[model samples]
Target chain A: MNNTDIKRITPKNITDKEFFYGHKACAGCGGSIAVRLALKVLGERTFAVLPAGCMSAVGFIFPQMAFVNNAIISTFPGSASMASGVSVGARALGLKDYKTVVFAGDGGTADIGLQALSGAIDRNEDIIYVCYDNEAYMNTGIQKSGLTPFGTKTTTTPAGKNIHGAQSFKKNMFEIMAAHEIAYAATASIGYPQDYIDKINRAKHTKGTSFIHVYASCPTGWGIPTETTVQIAKEAVDSGLFYLAEYQNRKFKLNKNPKSFFSAKDYLLKQARFKHLTDDDINIIEQQRDEKWEYMREHWK
Target chain B: MSNKKLFISGDEAVAIGTKLSRPNVISAYPITPQTVTVERLSEMVESGELKAEYMHVESEHSAMSAAMGVSAVGARAFTATSSQGLLYMAEGLHYASGGRYPIVMMNANRSLALPWSIYGDQRDSLSLLDSGWIQVYVEDAQEALDMIIQAYKIAENKDVLTPFMINLDGFVLTHTYELVEIPEQEKVDEFLPPFQTPNKMSFEEPKNLAFSTTPADNLEYKYQQNRAMFNSINVINDVDKEFGDKFERYYGGMVQEYRCDDAEVVMLTLGSITGTVRMIVDKLRDEGKKVGLLKIRYMRPFPEKEIIKLAKNVKAIGVVEKDISFGYEGTVFTNVNSALSKIDNAPLSLNFLCGMGGRDVSKSDIYNMFISLFNAVKGEKQKRVQFINMGVETDE
Candidate 1:
């Protein structure tokens, strides 16, 4: 998209809202940026339930919180369940103006917390569940997570002579959520702030359970320069390794498609975590990426 | 309005109590023995007899997490579980108590799995004594209903913001039917006010809850929780007294003493087993055996002061419990001994682990326990800890 098109799509009131400022997030932290943009769309009457993750550790540091609104820090796998309670309780107490939202990580969504997340969505609870996927468990020092893509090096998935990095592909949480037949499911990236904010706003307006999977880049874990965090996330989508899409009413639509898609090798070569990949490994990754894009194209069309 | 008497099981009585309490949210997962309680609650919600959000959670962990969320929003919340289900919720239990959410939950005390027994036992609730919750054991259906109603008042007290667990023995009190008095809704409403607290998540004056604390601040928060737990003793007594005065039914404060006045041998018990012991005590009293009964009502506050005062004059005290603390003695026996240790001239105590895995503690078993306590009071050396009715040969 051109600069004018981007400007036209972006919300005019985007400003330096300090609701989530003074957090302990690392430099060029895309997770914190996603949280900031999400709160902007949710506005002031939003109540949040944060599970054990980078957001829970950084945003809520006892007696001093970065959130202007109330936020309940939950157990590692309890964000969705707690949000269900908060939403129901708020309605029971006759508070209709406030919104209940859950901010969790990939591990807290697809792995340890999947059951609770599934329970909440199946009940069609009135809450917005947002997962900022940094691929690995960044808060616990970059361990492998189910959302971690194949052939990515994490502490647990160290590239060794006998074994490659994470052997399994990312657990397609967006598809899983869509399979639940929820009212809304979408994927966004920090590189596309306008798309991220717009999807979040759309989720906030939707009545039932709404889930947004955000591809938030972690420069510290991904072994990239702090300044290149957004660029890396953009490259991920542009390379077709990650796709921006939405699901509603049993229909899927692609939100952004690069005019000339880059190769998965180009995206992997930029990050040190994938530096151990050989030509054969890169070939497999490229094939998998192409298959995913083809799948999305078929579904979107 | 006059109270109505109905024949119901302990689980049904608990459902009635919860209905009268008017919780705004009840999240539960079905477990054996506790299933009927949740089932009855679901029926109430479905039939519009109780207006609440009943969340059929996927697991006990989610049930507790949801209860905490409901309570954090300044609305009354409830849940029920048993055995492994309670163990599954252990992590969230600490979170609920640490966050100081006044959630009231019911625990149908069942044996923990290993050998895999589903019958009644106190091991589940007894093992969680240090999880920072107010634990109460009821002897019958009537007390189960009444105490559950009072639990909300004690838990939601501004001075004592802690979760409460109303424990009734699985298959014993939970499945056994008895006559229980259902109090009028207006009276219950008058006794227990609508939940209102500043510790909730409010959009008007937003504040952080359950925030992460560093080592420097964590200790103070725990100390504050301890203070609240200690304060709950007074709140429990006050609420019990208020409930008694209003409903014309009273359960003795902390430890209910029956005919301990000039008795030389007093037996301490908890849960439904207390009822059988009460019968034995009455029969022994008729025979002029000088026996009495002390039913422990609240386990968390420990009732150390009351137990010490009661045991000081007795020659021997016997603690009969269904739970053993593994390498140690029965948990109730341990607490009673710890309390007695505070007194310089404390009475000699014996631990009688009975009715484990729902093994029936017949009248003869209660008679045998009393005989041992009587013999100990007469300076006859008896075993300090005896596993009553284990159906195995032992050196007597």
Candidate 2:
């Protein structure tokens, strides 16, 4: 859907009052949209803890938060821990009633904040830890992150005559978190609003730690058009590049069927981040997606 | 039952103490001194000796994090690490304390960063003093065991919902096996109550957790954490006294003074190094040096009143430390200076950085250090800090 039809599907039930609106986000930031949808699904019972990332900087201003309930703490790489503390403290005081949530970017989740995140999960800190994966550290002027997919050009991983974008592939954080044997962990995208909301609802009911990694598109960082944010995000999952799955009781289940898939080129061509790729490069990307798809299907099934 | 006894190392005793408390989960990563505690726990889980989920994480950071997760779910949890492993999980430590997950951890005190060595030093635990944890330093294997059990009681107390770290010196306590009275699980159950978190994720009571802290709520939450820590001071004494009365092991108060009555000189120490000071004090007493040793038990809420009270009658005080503060002085020395500042005409607080990077702090080192401190007091030429008999390397 284009900009004209956006209002129709934007969830009529959601109030126009942005829980964290009127803020500074690069005109079509996926983090902003995802946060909007997340708060929409979770409702006012939710409390948000964000670290030093784009959302922490722009999403919610002081005294006036985008969320309705409560907004507390800002410690880079410690959002999950802080959330865990609030939840645990509430529980200790017989106030076991509110949702405690942590919102972090890929840099905070996959890199620096990995330890604290791991600890919260290990402790089964009964909180929702959301990682809005926009590939790079967009708030820090587009530096590379462990979540940055290979061949995605950034300031650090410059696209040039000899140099490739990123040396390593995007670290599969969803699978890594699942390895901790947490009760609930799944992948979602701003592209599929219904599916994303359904997953958050599912996590709300699940006991122990719940992790949701949202594939958020960055119009400024990825050099994509402001309007096609959802379209690009959907194509990433539809192309089987980013699989949607859940892990519980040491078992994996694919939340979204990958049978009807599109070519990686459909997802790649639309974004400016992959504009430098040639036909041969697209083939390599398609090949990697297929291998990963087969590997996940093998283990998941 | 009154004289229950068993052969145990400091780490093993701590493991036994943890098992007695019946932690629902135990996550652990290996490190020297701290390794044995978790290793024994691993064996317990493997052999069905303990009925709990033992998460063997890839790293210390994950281990502590997992323990926090377990505790968040309204389950009692425990984890242990030492030195580099403790430093690696430093961020997680603050999370546990701040999150108010009463996770009990043990640190086998070892040296800090730079040219890494796995020897006894207080730097690892001391560095984490400001991380909002109820930190208690144990001097012997028995105290280590008793304190581990007490840590849970104090930390999980309704009035003080904070995590705690029981610090014990490596080698001196961890390596040297001793006779520790193994208490019955039934008795432990009666002494330590079950955990009940207020807002847990349950089918009957669903709730959101670890939510974001707004700027206004942030200050109040921090203030609450600090207030909880200060309140824990009284709770520590109560728990320790109650347990000591039941088990005949006295370790409730923060600092324990040894022969400070009418003493002219006072030497301060912590963890297993106190053994050396005990011998030094005995030797100095025979030689009429009027010297005594003040062992710091609870290092975090810092025993401010007790420290000032202990040093009130003394002429000069020397703080022998196993860790350096870097760019300034020793951590214990800094704490002593601050604590003593409150007293009227307090003793001279002399700082000494010694036995770093796992180097042994022998009786000779303590004796000589105390002698120099005594001489400094008599000659009225007191060097604020002494490097002690640390291995020296001078180059042209």
Candidate 3:
């Protein structure tokens, strides 16, 4: 659905209710922003699941829980299965209306949780799985994750002369989910709050498993200024380093395809994790971005 | 439907019992011996005989995780697994128990893999005894079915909101056919009303559940979990008694004593091996031997009290189990010793490490075990732990 045709809920129209707040999230935490906005769109009647990751760590500190909706912390690798259970449990219990949402991190989703998430999608579980990707295992002090971009340094994937940074590219999570032929799958960035909210709204209304991978920047882990988390995340999308896309009904749709991209070199230089990269490394990263966008431009609608 | 006798395998009995429990969610992956239970449940779901969400999860880890989800929403959940699959869900096992999710699982007792054998053994469940689950072993297909029904009532009790696992010997009980009197659905409904608990995420309260706690507050949660699991011993007795009153079958709470009245040498057994041990005991009794049998039903809220009471009268107790603690003794032997140690004058206990990796505990083997025990009572000096039916020479 296009913007004009769809009756969208903006900040002005969004509920004045605050469901997620007063947590230990970093000042410029994009993951927290994503969770707050998604919870707003899904509302208080939602059964939210936070796996053993960043959001769960910050939100569920025993007596000081931040979620206003009924929520539970799932095992690190069991977000999908647990979310599926919550949805079916409520349905089987004859609860007519409710949403089941999962807020997982990069490692929790792309690495450990992939199998369970795929299972849920295969079963066509009526739940929304929002993966707030911070590129690394931010909760555990910035260890490299499956979604960590190449040339980025983390505790696990350290930068040095022998190996500059992570030796692998970010996994194509959005497409991997699309390959399941899920009811809906989307890639979003915290930089673009409106787009992220729109995708969550689609997930809220979906009758089957819906996946939304929101690129949330980790200020503490990435060594970026707290206030620049959203800007940096948005710039990566604008620079074609990360693209916004959706998969529905066996079709891939590109949400944002800049005719003239922002500089990937500049985007990388802003983050401390990528500061160690040389000009040659930047060239390789930019080349990878160009190749990915070329294919997305040629293939996706 | 009225209660009717039907000859079926232990796995089929489990499926029937699960159906009667009326769980809202069942998530499991296919594993040997345990596969039949899920297959039958699937058929039931497809045929509209059971109305439940049968989630075909990709792994046992997810299977248990989903069951926790089912429980966290205050819905009844069921799952089945065997051997490696049980180990795969080990982390979730502790999580389910600690979360106070009253999920019921039927585990086919199979050996853990190294050389890899999909046969009857108590090692798998024994290995995970400390995972905070209330574990029970059945002697036959009938008890397997009956326990599957009672497991729900005991687990869902407000004072005992912990996960329960009903174990059946792989290939032996899981595959063996027996004439089982399936409880009528209406009667089972009366026995197990509905799973109700305060330990769930609710819309009315909007509570966050299963969160991390500071070390200051952590032990109290565990202390409470400990209380619930131990308190379940009474619930087990109460539930089994009520089941007997309604269904005409009673599993003697945590431990069942057969002919242990004034006996000097009593043999303890678990799962399907108990029947063979009972037969051996009966044969010795026919020959004028003062021998008896003790069957361990629940292993977690262990039959410590009953064991201590029984040991007070017995001269010696022999434990026949299929598990080893490696360089120590049988796991059950260790647990039984711990209980008997609590008393001033504990009886002489021997551990018989028999039937590993699904090997049959033949009646001959069980008879030999009793002979060994009877000999032990007669001041025969042998090792504390002996491997029965050993084919190879041991240095000892």
Candidate 4:
């Protein structure tokens, strides 16, 4: 769906009612923004399971919760399993209308929490597991995560003499979720609020297991100014670094593909995580980005 | 009340007890020794014999996590695991008890890996003594079956909302077949009412559960949890007594004492090994040796008063354990001594660590341990801790 189409379908009466607010997140934390927007779509009658991540640490600040709906802070790698239990318990209790959602970070989702995630989806658990990907382990102070891009400077992957930064490409989480053959798997960005809301709404209404991988920016971790968080996310998508798409019923559909993709070097230069990249590193990154873009264009219907 | 007997393993007995209790959710991952319990539960769920949601999780961690989820929604939930699986679910054990979910889990006691043995041992559950779970070690298939039913009531008691671990020896109890009297479902339904809780996850109130707490308020929550654990001792006795009155059976409330009134020597044990200890006590009694046996049923609410009372009358006591606390004596021995230390004149005690990795704790081994206890009572010099039948040569 295009931006205009998304806006046209968006609910005008959608409450700017912030279900989560006044927490300890950074000034322009993309993860909390995505959670706020997603909870707005999910509405009430929703129980959220937050793992040991930014959301759990900030949203649940001991005796002072920011969430309006029922929420729990489960163990680091148990969000999916906890959500599965909540969904099954709700059904067993004859409260099947209640929605169980898992709000986890990239470190919790792609690395420590992947096994439980796969198990829940494979069981076709009736829950929505949303991975707010900030590229690295931002809550733990910019440590390297599986979703960290190649040549990005995280705490573990510092730009030293011999090694530039991270040496691996970002893990394809959407592809992994799609492989589970879940009822719904989609990618959304905080920059595209309307598109993100639409995907969350669709996921909420859909049955079976639904996974939404949201590209959330971390200004503190990326060494960028807090005011440009949304701008950086938009540039990441427009520059072909991050793709927005949905996979359902064994069919792949591009959600919002840019008419003319910007240069990957420009996107990398916008954040300090990739500021140390050399000319050769940028060329390799740009080539890999274009190849991935071409592959998505050819494959995504 | 028809007391129909069924020839089955302790694993099957646990399944029967769970079926009778009518749990709302059963989540478990298959592990050795404990695998049969979940297998039977799954079959019951599939065959429509048990109406419940069975979640086949990826690991023991998820199993316990799911069980907590179910319990948080005012449903009785159950799960089973052993050895490494128990260690894997160790993190969730604290959560279940701390969150006051009242989940019931059966842990087929097995040895921890390293040398890698799936044999019967108490190391798994004994090592997790401080995880805030009310642990009950059963002696035979019958107690295993009955305690599984009693565990739910004890855990779900409003005064004691703690999770319980019903431990049965790996091969001895889990694999051995015996004629166990499976209670009728209606009797169990009358015994355990439907779980009712105001602390569950709800849409009407929308309260945060299992939330993060600062140090300022964290200790108070733990104090409440500890208070609940202390309260469970009374609840356990009441439930066991009520269960006995209904089912015409009693496992002697927490610590089962046999012939200990005027005995000079008493042997303390847990799990399946208690049977062999009791047999040794009978043989010793026949030989005119004033020997007795104290089978510990519940370990968490340590039965400190009962232990002190039992030991105060005896001249000497020996604690037989399948686990060692490494550097310290056996965990049970340590707890018993801790309880005894409070008394002015406690009995002379010794620790016998046997059956590690299921090395047989034969009848001869029990006789030898008794001999050591008798000798210690006579003021003979002896090692405070002994590894029974370890086959290792010690330069004494």
Candidate 5:
């Protein structure tokens, strides 16, 4: 009864009410765009939870709250748990036609908040949990996080003469949610607004727990031109570094299975964080991406 | 009709009280001494005897975090844990209180880890007095049950929206069985009306809660939070009086005094040890020792007025608590000293570190506490924090 019944929406016909606006966020902020768009799809009759990350830090300043709809900041590791609580609390109150959603950063979702997210999914709580992946702990000045990709230079994983940026690759968070046999799971990019907005719509129709891992870019943290955030985000998806996929009914499906991927090398060099990647490092990243797509194409429907 | 009286442990009493209050959500995580409370609650939920969203969370951190979530929607929430679990959710404790969520939690007070014992001690909750929750220690099963109902009423008061923590000494009160009178559901419903607060998220009026604070207004928010705690002092006493009118049982506001008036030597105690201290006072009074007891029910609005009033006529006051500030003195002792410092000639006060890690605070140790205070006035010098009834010797 609490699931969103909103009809199919496109960017041209999206609501201009601006549920989330103002306060402070960097120019061309991908996370903010994802948050604002998700709120638009879910509508004002929704309870949103944000953790102690970039989105919350930027949007929820004292004396100035950016969200017009109801939203609260949760503990760094307890975002999913607190969201689940809001979901149950509404149901207990005999509330009708309201969705509970969470917007957390990569570090908040995959690192400190992983256990809580798993528990909420295990309980099948009626919540649409969105993990906006900017690849590093940007709010804390760009520290390395579990979702930080390989060959990425963060404050914690600085590239040096001996050791490279990050020794290992990013954790497979989307697949991990799929492994839980979650009610609904998907991966999207801020670059593809229609596809990402539709994914939020798909989550609204689901009866139980749903997870969406959206690849949101960080201009300041990634050392990219602010205006190029959407372009780089779309390029990452086009380069096969990030794939759009969905899982439901215990089955995985790729939303965009590219026939021929774009140049992964150009995508990496576009950002300053990855500009430090050597020719050999670029080769390794491309190989890793190709290997992942090979498995995804073979296994995913 | 009056509800039936049953012989039950303090934990069971809490479960009954929780069910009667009809909380909308209960976040449960299991740990020793607190296991029975959650188990009973789970049974009630499973049998459909209690209507609640029973969330068996992964850890204590989520246990508290979830309760705060329930409270954010203006729904009643319940959770329980002991020593290490309490320490684990230490961050959530402050989060809930600062958020002004009137969630009622039962903390089965136990010793913290190091030596790693699962026994009763005040160290767990006492160590976190600054966590901003209103802390109350129950002396017996009846108080445990009664406080569960009253905690919600006091905490949910418009003036005091801080979270409330009800502490029952591990194994002592939590596991020990005693006869408790259960209140009728209809009567309790009348006493505690359905929750209504403008603080919650409602379609009628949307609000942003638990937002970030900057230096420009951070000081004012903290000052307001402190003022709310101060407001709870009267609310605590007033609720007790109202509960007495409705249920015929009353907990003496924050500090319960037993024969402390016109006494020469007084002993201050917290949690379950208050019962034994009362008996010790009774035993000494027969011998004309002029000893008395002060049971500190609430530790956070620190009972400053009660402590100062009880100390005025006493020759010397001794605080027997299960907590230690490690190098300095007992945590409760530190609070008592702070209260006593306000008056001139505050008398010689001593801190007796007894019952550490669930070790027994024998009747003899209590008797000695009274004698030590009496002798201190007689010019027999002693350490401020006396390590009493110890198996190991300490150089003095």
Candidate 6:
């Protein structure tokens, strides 16, 4: 048995009915599930600061509060700033037992919210900022966001015969957070529930700024079958397209290492977004993913 | 307890004041004009005189961020910058204020933006006038040092949960040397109490800070922040008097009006350039010019009541601005206009854009600017604004 396969002990036997019932999450929206699992480990002592995005629009608002603990909402990109304010206020109030979780979407975290997030991390504020990476602005009609992978087709990045969807690679926010030499930063996917929980748990107990980038499949944005959300997430990690790793202040630790190399085709073929891509396109993506995976495997332990 | 009356630059006096303030965290990046203050603080830290966490941040943004962090965790935080640096840290400035951290910062007033040059100006602070910070401009090094010590009390005052900024001119006040009394540490201790964060993480009792704003009443939260800013005006005045009584140094109740009693022509100015204008006002008064000076020490929380009251007494006012409003006219002049409009006997204020991009404003230039105001009062001068020593010959 490996570290990845180790059974994580459940704190208490709880009913499975807690998984947001009759929710409005678009088909395969793994963001809701990710938030649910994140909060399960975070418990009730956490306060989630939500910036305007998929997470805020979907998870919050109205009679439907996806969060159980205290939640604070800010503008489209002011989550980090508000979180900083809350951190100061909480510290001032001597309420250090409670954890401040900053949950934002890709556009909110990677683009507009970048300055405040970077500033917060650099300052090492005792806050957990989780970016639900859905590749695009799924809340705003599937618009191409900063986290949109190089070849994904979206409303903004419409693919054609000559033109591809996005012209750039996915922005590696995990790497950026790692560069700050923060106490803890990890990349996780909803597909790997135990691994995701382990990373969240690690971040919860640590002091200073901790970041977790979770791969949340957007059914509407990615144009995938809603029920296959978990499958897609699992495939991405199993194929080494999205590796699970952790960085504890400059020290790298790979949590899950795929036993053998699985081509990107095994991952992309299942998704409708990549269905239009020819073998040549698939081969190119596979090469890029393998190159990145090899680099991480070689340098990161 | 050395009774040392050293003739030091305003910049150096600020350094002494910062050292005396005993901040646990001092982080800043060097910018034109205000570089000396940080340089001196760095020296003090290096020499073991001040046992402080001195972080050489990459940018003003980082400096403010680091300061906010230190301040968040119950550290007495301080930082200094000017112009571009001020704007660079604009986002952090608001956060610090909202976080209610009594973070004291020194902003060396310099002209901001295009056709940009490193020089004394009020545009920097004026641009961030609504950032929820208590801003105080000092005409000399003495006040720069005195105001900084007082800022902590005013900012940390239980009612006023906000950050404070003491702005002085780059070269005009920061670089220029003057005789300043270095008050005893005991006196400072008595006047400004030891730095204590009201809300911060404590090992004895852990706390969570940086929570999200409650979505239910976020508007009320913003309103509360606004109210806190407005409340600082009175708090600032009260502390100014208390500090003055103890240290014999005060900014005269937040807004210092110099020689403006029963005068028709009032010349308005901020920062060290006010000293030159004050001299010009005295010269004009001796020549029976009926001119006086209204030196604006506090820019944020505005001092609107005092400005409107002062404007009601004066007939024609000349606003000497070291910074321009860009595309319009003067930054201070624009604010002064809004304040006076609320009064019964509002003065005819003229915006004189001068000393921009570090242009030296001499005594003669101030006198010339006042002379133009005199002509305007007499109906002899057609132009409302007379640019003194400004490079131009353009037809309006």
Model 2 lDDT per residue over A1-301, tens place: 0123233223655556556576678888899888877776666666677778998777455444444445554457556765665565445435555677788999999998898788778778778988999999999999899999878889999878786677678998998998898888989998987778767777766678899999999999998889988988998899988877777778887877767688787687777778787787777777888888788778887
List CA RMSD, all candidates: 2.3, 6.6, 1.3, 1.8, 1.8, 4.9
Error of 3 at B239 (Å): 1.1
Q: Residue B9 CA error for candidate 4 (Å)?
A: 0.6
Q: Weakest 10 consecutive residues, lDDT, candidate 3 chain B?
A: B358-367
**Model 1 docking grade:** high
Residue B66 in candidate 6 has what lDDT?
Answer: 58
* Residue B82 error, candidate 5, Å: 1.1
Q: Arrange candidates by lDDT, highest first: which order? A: 5, 3, 1, 4, 2, 6
TM-score of 5: 0.98
- The TM-scores, one per candidate, come to 0.97, 0.77, 0.98, 0.98, 0.98, 0.82
Report the C-alpha displacement of residue A278, candidate 1, in angstroms: 1.2
Worst 10 residues of 6 chain A by lDDT: A13-22
DockQ of each: 0.83, 0.14, 0.87, 0.74, 0.82, 0.14
Candidate 5 lDDT tens digits, A1-301: 1124657789678888899998598898899989989999999999999999998998889888898989999999999999988989889999999999999999999999999999999999999999999999999999999999999999999988887798889899999999999999999999998889889999988889999999999999999999999999999999999999999987888889989988988898888898888999988998999999999999996
Where does model 2 exceed 4 Å of error? A1-132, A139-141, A149-214, A223-227, A235-301, B47-49, B199-208, B214-217, B380-382, B392-396
TM-score of chain B of 6: 0.94
Error of 1 at B109 (Å): 0.6
* All candidates: TM-score of chain A: 0.95, 0.91, 0.98, 0.96, 0.97, 0.91
Tell me the tens digit of each residue's lDDT in model 6 across A267-290: 776676666677877777778887
Which window of ten consecutive residues has the lowest lDDT sum in model 5 chain A?
A: A1-10
Error of 2 at B92 (Å): 1.3
Local distance difference test, each candidate = 0.91, 0.79, 0.91, 0.90, 0.91, 0.77
Model 2 Cα lDDT, one tens digit per residue, B1-396: 266788889999999988888887777878887888988998898998887767656577766655665565578888899999988888777877777888999899887767777788888888888998888888888888888788889999988989999988888789888988887788778899888778344434433344456566798878989999989989988987889887777764787888888788888888888888898899889888688888888887778888788777888889888888788899888988998888889877788778887776677877778877877777867568777664675341
The model with the greater lDDT, 4 or 5, is: 5
